[model samples]
Target: MVIVDDHALLAESLELALNFEGYDARRVELPEEPPSETKLVSLITRSQPRIVLLDLDLGQHGSGVRLIAPLARAGVDVVVVTSSTDEPDWGHALHAGARTVLSKTMPLGEILGTVRRLNHGLSVLDVEDRERLIRAWMGQEQRIIEIRRRLDQLSPRESQVLEHLMGGLTVGEIAKLRVVSEATVRTQVKSVLAKLGVSSQIAAVSIAHQADWRAA
Candidate 1:
């Protein structure tokens, strides 16, 4: 087994525990920048480990979400061990092909059991975490639907204006882009805010970000 986490103490502790349980375990420090897909495949090949216990947040380096799919493709199971309470992180990790997402707060015994189950090709999520992940996915879907509905209420020009706003354009910048007067752009901005039920450009932008409206 290999553990990939930024925190040295936690990695060392987990290494100790796994070794005590008679498994060959080691901690592989994450690079400052995440490795390329080919490099990652090479590392996994070299490690020849059955499971990878990964952490998403690697301080300045960034997320481990990008590692999951490649590891899965390489036939190495990934168990996401994170302290993040945000549902999207969990959802994203699972969607990217993690074996299971485990809270850092879970007991070591439970974590060990999860690892063992993965080694034996069994699903390890508890019923509660499964339901929570489902709820989180449902909530995200509903939010996207709502955002889409609100966006549908906009005129084509208004939709264009909202996209610019979410892209961090000022009223003046947007007006220049649309070849319209600043006043006209401001009017469209107000219309967008009203339709989206937001009070300001920042609020509207926040909604846009949450809904991933730019992608739409």
Candidate 2:
């Protein structure tokens, strides 16, 4: 088995423990400066482990989630062992053809037990749970599409005003910051509210939070 993760200490520890348990496991640390996807995939494929354990967050290397599809396509049994509790992340992994997603919070013994089961050609993940996560991921994707449609209705300046509102600014405050009149700011705020389909600033901000919007 091969472990691909950026947390060197944790990866090394897991590797040592798995080896001690009589399983041939090794750690492949994701470097801070990551290589292109093609090179990265090539390196992983060369190792040719029976099973590949991966982390979703690969530090500056960004999400290793995208690797799931290609690795699975190459006939690698990709097991995701991650710290992320987000259902959408789990769902995304399942959609990308991962064998299963396991939490790091699960006891090492339990994790190893699952690996043993996989080696023996037994089912590891529950079908119901897997289906649930896939549904959550699909729902999350739909919500993002809808949110984009709403926000995309805003003019460029309205987008800026929405960002300012999310930053905890009042209309008057935004006017001063943008060197505009109070009436102009209020008009823009009204337009933002209308475009976002929210009657209040609080609701509009909630939408931004859901979209993980950042001020530009």
Best by lDDT: 2
Clashing pairs in 2: none
In candidate 2, position 151 carries an lDDT of 90
lDDT of residue 96 for candidate 2: 96
In candidate 2, what residue range of length 10 has the lowest lDDT sum?
Answer: 24-33
Question: Highest TM-score among the candidates is held by which one?
Answer: 2
Task: Give the per-residue lDDT digits (tens) of candidate 2, residues 1-216.
Answer: 889988887688789889998988998755557899877877787878878889999878779888999998888888999999999999999999998999989988888888888888899889999999999999998998898788988888998998999889999899999999999989998988888888999999998889887655
- Residues 1-216 of candidate 1 have per-residue lDDT tens digits of 999888898889889999999899998865667676578556655768889999988776568888888888888888999999888679778877787898888888888888888887887877687667757866887887898789779888888898888888999999898898999999989999999988999988888887767633
The lDDT values for all models are 0.83, 0.88
Q: Please give each candidate's TM-score.
A: 0.69, 0.90
Clashing pairs in 1: none
Model 2, runs deviating above 4 Å: 166-170, 199-202, 212-216
